[model samples]
Target chain A: MVGPHHAIKWLVFALCLTIGSAHAADPEALDREIDQLKSDVAALSQTLFDIEESVLHPADTQVAVFLALKDKEGLELDSIELYLDGSPVSSHLYTDRERESLRQGGIQRLYIGNLPHGGHQLKAVLTARSANERFIRREVRHQFRKRPGESRIQMTLDASAPDYEPVVSFQEWK
Target chain B: MQGLNNRMTFKRWALAVLFSAAGVSAYAQTGHPELDRGLAQFALGAGNGALALRYTQNAETEQDYLLRAKALLKTGGQSEAVRLLDALIEGDYYRGEAAFLKSSLVSNDQEERRRLLQIAAQKGHGEVKQQASYQLAEMARTNGRPDTAGKILASMDTGYWAALGYMNIAADYGSRDLNPSRALISLRVAMAMAEEDPNKERGEALKAQLLVRAGLLAYESEDYDKAITFLEKVRLDSYSTPQGLYLHGLALTGKGKHRDAMQSWHRAKKYPLAFSGVAESWLGTGRGYDLTGYLGQAGEAFLSASATYESERVTLRKLADMVREKGAYAALLADAGETRAEWFLADSRMLTQPRSAYLLRFMENAGNQAAVHRVKELDSMLARMERQEHTLKVLTSVLDERLANSASDNKPALGHVRTEIESISARLIAARQNATPGSSSVETIRHLAQTLKDLETSTDRFDKRLHKRDQRLRVLHQKASDALEKLDHRKRKATDVLRKANAALDQKFLAYIDQESERMLVALERAEQQIAHLYEYLALQNLGGGSQ
Candidate 1:
């Protein structure tokens, strides 16, 4: 036993409730705005990085070194000290969490700097522990000629099986 | 209808990005074993797949190809994964794994999967021989032959994991599937095999878990002595320690050692309540105390258990509400040290996450994990596209400036030269009309030469205005403008879709939170009931003592 006027009023009330609830529950509007700004800011960084590379270290003189830990090497990295052209350029001490992250396997950029197009030396001193809790320290030096465009070195900490001795090797990426 | 269109657009955009990213750069395989590994572990090892794929896009090695195939599957490119796997299989690199994975992906037909599984089982390559054999055994079981399943499991080729699987199935038989002796025998075999697993930390952890499982099965069958022997050897640091201690307490109670049972339950209750038997251990402590004629202490123990559960319930509700309010993308990152990097593992700080156990359990579901991952990927893609958009804007501006300098700067001078050429042609036609046929031919020739010299002098001043350079600049400008327009349009569409997708993911996260909230409530209610019953018993005991 409802009148048409009352029915209309009820429908209007329900519509308002729906709109109000939707608005109240929606945090995505603010999030969306913030993300858009972040995206816009990120856009500026791409060009900024490109400009930084050309302006700071021109391609002809740029040298980049990358590092990676061998997968399932049965050894834990402790620390690394790196030298480029007899100058200390980079060093890192690995925490347990950092070591765990590295265990999942990905290349980490060690250093990037300007070196003239000619022969340059990269020296690394690494300290790591084997599965048997044996502490090992190793030092290795590599010499490579920088090319016209860009020079990149991929450094790896590997282990030989059975005794699982830690070995550090460097390869120039082509 | 609008949502559908946006989804389709997003899918097309995602496909384009993946396919284009698949265009690998040429690089000679460095022959380093490290080159074979990638963040591909992120796909299966709780890392990011697209990020991993990005770093390894220039892979040249067959092993790298296998890694990419796995990564592609994680990123929803199943067909692409299948194609890569097929190539690897044909080339005789990881043929077993490739065949098994591709067969699973490329068809829904059971017959086809079985055939490929058979191929994988017989193949010599790939590290999934045990997994493939297990699948075959499972398929046989599904076809209603339990005997055949057991036989298949028993006949798997000899390896650490393979032999362990055989022993595991035998242990399964010990659970009323076969004689109790067989179960005990198989569990002993599994225990021995697990000790030989090469993985150091994981091997030790698994061995401890195996002992707990064996002890539980034994305790279930009223073999208290055997159960105590197995449970006593469990490492305190192992994940199963709570369950082990709880079961050990029960075994002690069966032997009528009330004090020993209480001590074991006391140790078990010290662990996180998220542990399977930790809450039950609390109740067991109360029950032990009541049996030992310490009814007052028993009542206190039950009250303590109830309070602990109620506290956890409050924390769970607060966390769930936060997830619902902030949306999943941000809430997910807040639990672990307020940084995305902290997600590699849970932070142990109580202040940072009061309910890390429950949250970790929630993330164990693959769907919930994917919900978070999808939002992350979308945000990353949007940021990348935004960066490209800015770079394109700079490019367009540079091109426009060059076009202006090279062409627009000389536009007026070129126009004047065109007018001069027209005027000279008109004058020459007038002279031709005025002249008699042959008279003064030398004079006419001299006049024409002077006019040509004048034209040459004027045109020489404007020599920098090369038509070819102008045309090139104009074409470059037009192309850059067109590219800018298309990218802008796509970015707008992508922004809209990513926002909506993010909101949808948030709802999924909220759903998980709701489910966990319900579980916490149930546990809290059970604890409250136990506390009330314990208090009632204590009151009845006091009343009987007074009457006596």
Candidate 2:
């Protein structure tokens, strides 16, 4: 093992290299980083494959979707705010005011009759945490419908793809 | 550090043997030595199939074969897995686990389904145990061992196993069209267990199936109320299964709700073959239209039904007796015929009542027929005697009523009235005796007439005093009312005393008539005796001895 003095020297060298090269690195260093990324991707693929491989066919674990509705309107009105994990999946603009009830606390709730499938919102409240960082408190509010035969129901919230990965893993009971 | 070194050494030894099994050709397939080594490592991790195939086609590497055998199941080689498990069992290495897994994958037969279930019960994980038990129950039912299925299901106590078991039993009962009570009991037990097991998915489906079946059984038993209740429960739960809807339709039809029944039947068009063809034929024959629509539509429906019914020879034969009776009032008849067995079972006693009475009267008047026939070659003595006896009974009852009225009338002589009634009754009894010598009813009539004659004499004498007493009471009431206006005068005092005297005198006259009471008591006793005699005569007629 290297002594603490050697580790400190290496750390300083890494910092100096980062500050000097910044956006322009040597080809050798670039190649090393590319190789490292390739290895990381392959490792990730293997880990996923291994986890999937562990389960026997006719698996004990099943993925299920609970399609719940609070108050659904059918074929009468269109467009309602939707919430997923307590955060709004849409811009805070009200499209159907007759259905959207506004309370005194600046909180908006939609009385949705039905949702169209695919590319919809999970109506939620966006609370500002600070000037730079905003915190989203989300609730699973509505599931929109799509024209029959759509494959996936995409919840289009400001949160990035990494935030809603858990839903894809579930297999609906039907 | 020593342990890590040892583990690495073991892994390296394993990897080297596996890599060398690929032979020189596979080695040359990868250009660089480092890349070849990586490929070899990936191949080792590629699972038993890669190792075994590499070993078989290239080098005869025993290490690759050994590892291949250990992980054979990972490659979907179930038979190979079983073989390896057999070898492991012989070697006593993971014997139980290997044997259990091998049994599970290696068999699809029902017997194997049962055996695996038993093994699961003995040594399986929680979910495995539950699933295996359910599978075994289904296998048992398929193999015609419902009792075995029931016992296994009972032992399960909860979850999908119990629900499936109950559902199977219900189906078995439905198939045989017998032992519905037993089937219902099993289904209810299953439903109860399922309700307690919150995570069980089969609960709702099984409950719906059981309810539909129970409703049908009740319908068959003619318990319309219960059938409606169970079937309505299924519908309220939004159970739209073909059989459930069909039975709901049947129950509605039973309750005479033909409009609703038609709606249900229309929905049941999805399962054409599920119902008996007779029901389909009934529907086709305009039964629904007859109930709810224009007569023109009904005729069309019937015509279509007849065509369809005739097309299927087997169904035609089964339903020939049913649909041939169709008309405006045919539904009532069909309903009656269906419940005929129930009616016979229920009113067997009441049906015997009038049957015995008619038979008795016939035999009493026809008992001498054989004797007369023996005397004449061509004759109906019984018919002649029956006619005579019937004529006499009619004459006797008419004359008796007439004589009774005349006796009660103050203008008619009591002796003449009595004479007329007695002579008519005597003639009727003599006629009955001549028809059937030993008939008890003839003697009973004679005794009744004598008692009535005695009652008539006493009634006439009592009526004389009663009429006089009534007249006196009416006069005394008038006197009492008149004396109220003259209460202070001597005339009022005199009238009051006279009214009291008149009331006492009327009471004395009524008390003197003991003969009327004695005659009524005697007449009533005779009437009771005549009723008893009639019952005995009826009994004799039923047994075919009244003619004698």
TM for every model, in the order presented, reads: 0.65, 0.33
lDDT of 1 at B102: 79
lDDT for each residue of candidate 1 in B137-167, tens digit (9 for 90 to 100): 7777657665776776676644456545645
TM-score of chain A of 2: 0.22
Give Cα-based local distance difference scores for all models.
Answer: 0.66, 0.43
Which ranges in model 2 have alpha carbons more than 4 Å from their true place?
A1-174, B1-76, B84-101, B104-115, B138-148, B173-179, B194-202, B235-240, B269-285, B291-294, B300-548
Candidate 2, residue A9: CA error in Å?
98
Q: In DockQ, how does model 1 score against the reference complex?
A: 0.07
The local distance difference test score of model 1 is: 0.66
Q: What is the TM-score of chain B alone in each candidate?
A: 0.67, 0.38
Q: Tell me, per candidate, how large a share of the native contacts it keeps.
A: 0.06, 0.00
DockQ of 2: 0.00
Name the top TM-score candidate. 1
- Taking the tens digit of each residue's C-alpha lDDT, what string does model 2 give over A1-174? 999999999999999988765533343343233333223322222322222222111111211111111222211122334354454434443332322221101111122123322233334332312212434343434433222221223222222233321121111111
Instruction: Report the lDDT tens digits of candidate 2 across residue range B407-433.
Output: 335535656766776787678667665
